[model samples]
Target: MTDIARIRLLTTVEHSLDAGQQVVSLANDEDPLTLKDRVGSIERIELHFPHFTDGRAYSQAYLLRRRLDFKGDLRATGDVLIDQLIQMERTGFSSAVLKEGVDPTDAERQFERFPAFYQSDVVNETPVLRRNTPES
Candidate 1:
């Protein structure tokens, strides 16, 4: 399993998703852009929550996966905690970028905090087929 790592920096939303450009995005609080729009062209999105208490990025990540079906890389940066790491994965983030000055090795151990599966209410049963007697 190859751990996803940050390779580049994207300063603007438009620039990040543009077909002509591929840059890692870091969103700020005042960006005023929805996660749906941001992920449309983004190759990878990094949510920047200035504080742990700030929950906007959580919602953003959720929308990216649940609503937009974003399959590319997703990461959380800034003010991340052990408590939030599992929720981050549940919300559809593929990776987490430890805050500055933190050791990246420690994060690999954080995976134990979250359960592996999310049960859903929707169900589909396999259809059964019965053969009818041949007409004589």
Candidate 2:
């Protein structure tokens, strides 16, 4: 979960990505890399969630958008649940790499069983704002 760990993961993966900029996986604990410091200036960011019970990547992705203003591909990798896809999209993820052996065809169908929006007042992992209101 350290920056070094993230860098190591990035270096290990080989894939056809967005473009000249590196397409790399980042750990939740790693400090966000600024645009200038990134190799070839990162065009695609793959956020890793070590487990479904761990949601650090969601916050990482949110910060990348709301704070750093990253306007490129955001991909969720590892321990992705079918139920979380819509929220992931809402959180700014453009794509997801399903865990090994998870069927793509069944993912969407399974996802529909969960409510698209929740009714809650808490702000934590997967914030559900304005839950008290009827619109929520």
Candidate 3:
């Protein structure tokens, strides 16, 4: 990937998804509903959570995956805390850019805290009860 398209100093949500860029970062308040039709075309989309308490991005992630069927990179950016990584992954975030001060090793461990998920999520599209395989 070219640095021009791959590395961007994103501080806000002003990205206009284009063929040239591999990533598009959005703000917490930006509505994915407005971009539904073209979401599938983008190779990667990053949803920002400006604050740990703001949960709007969670819905945005779900809409992109379950509604728009966005199958590419869904990354989490800004204020990404250790406690939220697993949930972020469950909500369709393929990767994350943790804010300063959060240790990468600790975050990695936290992500593996839940080896099994129950409900149907982006990580496991099939609900445990609906799976054909036997339960653990």
Q: Best-fitting candidate, measured by lDDT? A: 3
**Per-residue alpha-carbon lDDT of candidate 2 for residues 84-130, written as tens digits (9 for 90 to 100):** 76566656676677666666666666545654455321112333564
> Number of backbone collisions per candidate, in order?
1, 0, 0
- Winner by TM-score between candidate 3 and candidate 1: 3
Better of 1 and 2 by lDDT: 2
TM-score quality measure for candidate 3: 0.76
lDDT (Cα, tens digit) per residue for candidate 3, span 1-136: 1111121222223223223466677788887777777876788888988899998899999888787878787777778787987787777777677676666677778745676767877767777777798767
Q: Candidate 3: RMSD over Cα atoms?
A: 7.1
TM-score list, all predictions: 0.57, 0.61, 0.76
- Which 10 consecutive residues of model 1 have the lowest summed lDDT? 121-130
Steric clash pairs (candidate 2): none
Q: Rate the local accuracy (lDDT) of all candidates.
A: 0.56, 0.60, 0.71
Give the per-residue lDDT digits (tens) of candidate 1, residues 24-131.
Answer: 555655332455566667776777878999988877776666567676767676787656666666556676655555454555556655433334210101112222
Candidate 2's displacement at residue 3, Å, is 30
In the predicted model 3, the residue pairs found to clash are none
Q: Rank the candidates by lDDT, best first.
A: 3, 2, 1
